[model samples]
Target: MQLNYSIEGGDFTNAGNASSQVKKILKKLNVDPKITRRVVVALYEAEVNVAAHAYRGEIIVDINTERIRVVLKDEGPGIESIENAMTEGFSTASAEVRQMGFGAGMGLPNINKNADELNIKSDVGVGTELEIITKLK
Candidate 1:
């Protein structure tokens, strides 16, 4: 199965909407709860990142019998250093974002922890692309 979702930056009210929908679908499909949890965590983190940092974003989710893959593409002030961004507590979030109790900088780290595999690419003035995959078996 495949699913697609769009995200608007600075839209805190709906940051996790895509993740929530995916979670519901996974549960109904009888995907293992543990695996479901991992997918949800990774997806939620990615979703929040786009909402907090991008002008807009798109998420594509693909599910097969063996694994699940999610691709997130966002248009915004791209990360200048993926290395630094990956560090725990590293954040570029605005004061307004921080005030909302989001953007604590754990987004990428948590996604890395939950995803079996992750790939990221970014351009300093362009945007970012992230691919997160998890084995179902």
Candidate 2:
């Protein structure tokens, strides 16, 4: 099955909607609990990143018998240094964002930890694309 979600930038209240929908689908499909949890975590992180950093973006989810793939594409300020962005305690979120209980600098790191295969591509002034795949066995 394939699912697509449009993430509205700067909408903190709706940030996790995509992840929640994905979780429901996985559960309905009887995907393993562990795999579902990992997918949800990674997807939630990606969703938050798009809402917090991007001007606009969308998440594409592809699920098959063997694996689940999530692609988050955003047109925004674009990450200048993906290496630094992946660090556990690195963040560029504003004070207002931090006050909302996010921006603890754990988004990318947590996504990386939860995904079985992760890839990030970014252009300094253009945009960013994050691909995360988790295998189900």
Local accuracy of candidate 1 as per-residue lDDT tens digits, 1-137 = 99999999988789899999999999999999999999999999999899999999999999999999999999988999899889999998889889988879898999999999999999877899999999998
* Candidate 1 regions with alpha-carbon error over 4 angstroms: none
Q: With candidate 1 superimposed using the best TM-score fit, by how many Å does residue 5's alpha carbon deviate from the native?
A: 0.5
TM-score, candidate 1, is: 0.97
Worst-scoring 10-residue span by lDDT in model 2: 7-16
Model 1, residue 98: what's the lDDT? Answer: 90
- For all candidates, what are the clash counts? 0, 0
Q: Which clashing pairs does model 2 show?
A: none
- TM-score of every prediction relative to native: 0.97, 0.98
**Distance from true position, residue 22, model 1, in Å?**
0.4
Question: In candidate 1, how many Å is residue 54 off?
Answer: 0.3
C-alpha local distance difference test of each model: 0.94, 0.93
